[model samples]
Target: MINLFRSYNPLNILWLAVLVIALRIGYIIGAPDKLEFVFVESFARLLVPVSYEYALTPFLNVLLAGALVFAQALLLNKLVNQFNLLGKPSFLPALMYVTISALFTPFLILSAPLICNFLVIWMLYKLFSLYKGDDIKSSGYDLGMIVAIGSLIYLPFIYMFLAVWIALIIFRPFNWREWIAVILGYATIFFFLAVLYYLNDRFHTFYKIWLPLGTQFPNHISINNYTYVLLAPVVFILVLSVFKLQQGFFKSYVHIRKAFQLLLIMFIIAGLSFYVKRQFQLNHFLLCVVPVAITFAYYFLYTTSKWFYESLYLLLLAGIIYFQFNTF
Candidate 1:
């Protein structure tokens, strides 16, 4: 794996960049309503304090949001690159990882938590790479601070506390100091966001946002249509891989054995999806999507390296374009 990175050609980077751009173009072309506004008005109205006469501009929000989405694609790409050594997920996998991040992950640009996604990825990377007794406490504290800032942007992102704590324990075992730092992270979000609310004169919204457990919010909603766009094929390959694992195909193959980390990441995303949906917070949240993207990237390369698997991915891409591209 180390040699692969060192020996990789510059053209490969260009190819990956071109492919990523192709994905952005395809997404813009096929987006439902295609750059035209639909329901963001309601959100814009919700962004400003009721007392403020001027609502935030939807145009600016979406334009800014588009930039964030593009940035997320880049981040997801780098994330796959950074972690690929763990699973050896490749350039194609990076594309798939990024797509899943953008496609179905919680909180799209319309949601405030987009900011959290950016911050959490960096913190998680640091957490994932930490060594034994290497200041998990400080990392956790920094993680907490990032969450506090993210929550100020979108309140529910406080949930990222779950990710931060879990990552700390999984990737780097911690002691009492780290746990305290995690607690500090949670408390900091509340304190800082409250300060923002007080300044905005919308102090009441802060309580509703922070103490969500008290509210009887309606079930979150989403349309599952066209998930076959990617899910069916990805699932089939995963099923085959699972069967192979059961049959001991991976007994001696180190990379195949290690790829289960990608599987774990995928599971985390799926679990978080249901968690977010139950709360009616259906925006494309970063937490749900980041793992999904990693899973997709891992498997995309996994399938593409085999003749049968490569054929399947081609068919899947063709089907997705056929089903999804007509709107373009």
Candidate 2:
């Protein structure tokens, strides 16, 4: 399977579809009767002024989510190849993304963080272009708005605003205007939201959106031990990818190095920002899959041991399918 995706072939998409179904089939068969889809965050509910939670049959829920994951994987793969991030094109990123997105049951269904991934990919495309463009103030502003939009879907997504500044620092010189443009961009969305609040006579509740920012980090998070077991392969691959990157970090082109650095920061911010949501769940980490899949692609592309990498990827697939059928 790894060998099949190691090259960029259009036919591989058929295999990717099969992979998506196979990974999700077990859960779909045993899924709960009622699946709740949270289309937006609570504050966003007020802003959109519609039903945020909708109940759907298990099969329909998984099917829609599967379609979304497939589309996002292709989009991310396009972005990776566009920038020559992996030195050459391959379907590995898409394959890895489909695999990673199914790592947890919650991720296999429709949720706010899963929906926000499209914005994450859009941000990456604009973020990577910063290196080539002469003036990126527009890009900064767009990114700020993008992050704000994503925050509307998932509140923790607000932290991605930091990545806009980090990208400016890595890809461009110190320009205060570019730095400040992001803030104005972020506020642009909220300004309208504030207006809506005032018109609705709910201006008093507008301040509650930022209250989560002040919440203290929990001393400990109670997670099932099996969740760690499920993450074992993910941890192994990330550690290997880090060492593999470190080995050739300076050897890569300047733009590529900075791009990877920015991605690493984005991953950290996305992963840690979940603490801000009082009712966070594993699905929130779907925001990290784009960067993590790219990192996995890097290691798989460069690693010389064909048999070892092949077996490692197989182990990951087997684990995902196995866990889906039998719960810990």
Candidate 3:
């Protein structure tokens, strides 16, 4: 399976779909009867007028989420290839994405972070374009709007707005206008949302939206110790990937280095942004999967030790399936 995805063959997509189902099957079979599809944040929910009674059945919900994951995997794969983020074109990013997205059952369901991933991909496209050194004030504004839209779906996604500036810093010379353009673009969305709040006589409630931003990071989160065992393979793979990148870090192109820097910054921002939400949900980390998947693909793409990388991938797959069934 690892070798199959290591090639860029179009036929590999069929196998990728099969892998998606295999990874998700255990959770789907054991899924509870009620599976809520939550695509909007609490503040946005109030304005959007969602009906609780309109929820999809668990099977269909999982099916739709699986389809979304597949679609996202393909999009992410395209993005990595388009930018040549990986040395050569291959489906490894897509494969790694599906695998990591299924690492937690929470990631298998419909959630705000899952929905926001599309915006994240979109932002990456614009971010990468900054490498051309073209005037990108418009791009900055667009990225800000993307972040705003994502924040409407998942509040933690607002942190991605920092990525807009971070990309500019890494990819372009100092341009204060471009820097401020992103802010204007971000405010552009909320400006209208504020007007809607005032018209509906709920303007007072609008201030409450930023309240969560002030919440202190938690001292600890309640998670099963066994979950760490499940994550061991993932952590191991990421560490290996980081070390591999470090070995060749300076030899890589300047743009590749800057791109990786921006990606690392985005990963940290996405991972820590969960603190803004009063309740910590594992699904929130789905935002980090994009960068992590690309990183994994990098390692798998470059590593010469075929036997080791392939076995590690299989081990990761087995861990996912076993834990999905074990439900620990």
Candidate 4:
């Protein structure tokens, strides 16, 4: 399976579809009784007046979400290759993304973070463009607005505002206007939202939108033991990827090195920002999948030991399927 996706091939799409179905087989078996069809976070409804009621059955919902995530994984693969983040173009990023997106059952469904991933990809594209562009302020504004829009879907996503500033520091010289542009662009979204609230005579509730930012970090989260067991392969792969990154850190090009640094910051911010939601959901961690997938791709593409990497990849897939079915 690893060998099949190591190269860039259009035929991989068929295999990817098959792989998606395989990963989702557990959800399909349980169907409408055990799975949820439409999941909307409380804050999501507060931010957006509309609700998503597809009127579709649970099986159809799972199928549609699987299709959407697969499509996004492919798009993310293209974005990484287009930016030369992996040093060379390959299908490994897309393959890794499809695998990781199914690591948890919550991630298997259509959720806010899944939707926000499109914004994450867009922000990354704009951030990479900074390497060659002269207009830092315009790029900063665009990134800020993208983060703002994403925050509307998942409030914790506002944390990505930090990535915009961090990317500016990585790609360009110090500029105060660039910093201010990010703030202004972020405020622009809420400004209109406030007006909508005022027009509806619910202006007082506008302040409540920021309440999540004040959530205190809990001392403990009750994670199932089996979940940790399922995480073993993922943790192992990330450790290897980090070691691999450190080994070649200095040998990479200047842009590529800085890009990886930016991604590292993104992973940290995305992971830590989950506290802002106050309610701990595995779905929130989906925010980290983009950077994590890129890191995995780097490991698979550059590692010399074919058997070791192949075994690791297969182990991850097997663990995901086993845990998915056993969870019930």
Candidate 5:
């Protein structure tokens, strides 16, 4: 299965869909009678209202989630390929994305982070374009607005506001104007939102939108023991990816080096920002999956030993399935 996605082939898309369904099969079978779909304080609902009621059967819910995630995986794959982030065209990024997205059962369903991922990809596109363009102000403004929109979907997404500054540091020289542009762009969104509230005589509630940003760092989180087993493979892959990156660190092109640095910042920010949510949920970690998938792709693409890499990939798939059935 790993070898099949090592190259770019149109037919591989079919296999990708198959792999998505195969990974979700266990969860589909064991899903609860009434699967809840919650969109906590999502401003996106104003645009597209999601039905919170579990009117559909568990199987159908899982199926629908699987389909949505599968499509996201494909789009994510296309984004990576479009930017040539993997150094060469291949299906590895998509495969890794789908696999990592399923590592946690909570990630299998439609969630805010999953929706915010589309914005993340859009942000990356604008960030990467910085290397080739001289228009820092416009790009910074666009990225700020993108992050602002994402925050409306998932409040923790506001943390991605840091990535814009980090990307500017990685891709451009010091310029205070560009930095200010980001702030201006972010405020632009809320300025309009505040106006809407004022017109509706609900301006008093406008301040409540920032409440999630004030959540304290968590002291404790109860997680199943099985989740630790699930983390083992991911940790191993990340360790291997770090070592691999170190080996070729200085030798890679300047743009590639900066891109990896930007991705690292994204991963760290996304992971830590989960604390911003008052209630800790596993699905919140979906924000980390995008960069982690790219990191996994780096390891899988560069590792020389076919037998070892393939075995590791299988181990990851097995871990996800086993834990899904064993735990939930």
Candidate 6:
């Protein structure tokens, strides 16, 4: 039983999960009257009023996503193991990825910027997850699907396909089949969305919904705040871990450099999300956090230096202070 439990866990996954849920609860509890849920939270609220139990009602959508987060986690677990051909990674990696992803949850459709940002990260993760496969068509299809699905969520996410194509050229040379998958996947979303557009009598109004929301002025979100608490020590260790990994052959489970690829893809996603429209929100870029945390957790927990760990904790504490001050 001990071995089984150990096999299932390593560092702080459960605690992290609790913390993630708590953050959402914090938002719900501390929410100002007009605050309702964030943009996508409103999507859930659409199904049920705040007076009803969030678990059993409109909040079900959020609950569904949370459930999907686990499914996504399972897929990601398989990804790390398969990409690196490394045995199971430590639990810290899982905690970091899942919890950080959750930290960004309040943003999904929080506003246009957040929606765009989350979509970018989702596409990037899907791209990185395909690193180990030999079937170019399959990988291309996956990439295409990510582009389409993410684009459907927020149209600007379609631009993420540029990174996908570039990464394909850089990492795995392209096959025409990949292009076919991308086109097909994209067409699939359009077909359904087209149908919905007609139903809404807005087939001509694609520009209205698909158009970028007017860029809002920058709101008050300091990187220092989240970096200290929500992101914390993991960020410090993650950057150093990359340097450490570079010092040696890409030995471990990720011979294909899946985790590294994940970072690049997510960074590109985050960067592109911002460039697509400037009015960024704290929750918007969260999708990137999942992979960010994962890479950080795996690399940080396994770091060989006390200095790195200490610096990380300190930075996190700084972030916490920032969070407390901002009430973020």
Q: Which candidate should be chosen as best, given lDDT against the real structure?
A: 2
Instruction: Give lDDT per model, in order.
Output: 0.51, 0.91, 0.89, 0.85, 0.84, 0.51
RMSD of each: 6.0, 1.1, 1.2, 1.8, 2.0, 6.2
Q: Positional deviation of 103 in candidate 1, in angstroms?
A: 4.6
lDDT string, candidate 4, 140-179, tens digits = 8878888888888788889999889889889989889989
TM-score between model 5 and native: 0.94
Q: Could you estimate the TM-score for every candidate?
A: 0.67, 0.98, 0.97, 0.95, 0.94, 0.66
Question: How many clashing residue pairs are found in candidate 3?
Answer: 0
Model 3 regions more than 4 Å off = 52-54
Model 5 C-alpha lDDT per residue in residues 61-170, reported as the tens digit of each score: 77877787788778878878887777888898889988998998888876778778878888888898898788689888888899888887788889899989988888
Candidate no. 1 TM-score:
0.67
Question: Where in model 1 is the C-alpha error above 4 Å?
Answer: 1-7, 24-84, 87-89, 101-116, 154-156, 172-174, 200-205, 214-224, 240-286, 300-305
Model 1, 182-202: lDDT tens digits are: 788667756755676677687
Q: Write the per-residue lDDT of candidate 2 for residues 1-328, one digit (tens) a residue.
A: 8888999999999999999999999999899878899877777677566654555678989999999999999999999999999888999999999999999889999998999999999999999999999998998899999999988888899999888888988999899999898999999999988898888898999999999999999888877776888899999999999999899899999999999999999999998998887875989899999999999999998999999999999999998899899886
Q: How big is the positional error of residue 125 in model 5, measured in Å on the Cα after superposition?
A: 1.0
Which has the higher TM-score value, candidate number 1 or candidate number 4?
A: 4
Please list the residue runs of candidate 5 whose C-alpha ends up more than 4 Å from where it truly belongs after superposition.
40-57
User: Considering summed lDDT, which 10 consecutive residues are worst modelled in model 5?
Assistant: 39-48
Scored by lDDT, model 6 comes in at 0.51
Between 3 and 6, whose TM-score is larger? 3
How many backbone clashes does every candidate have?
A: 9, 0, 0, 0, 0, 12
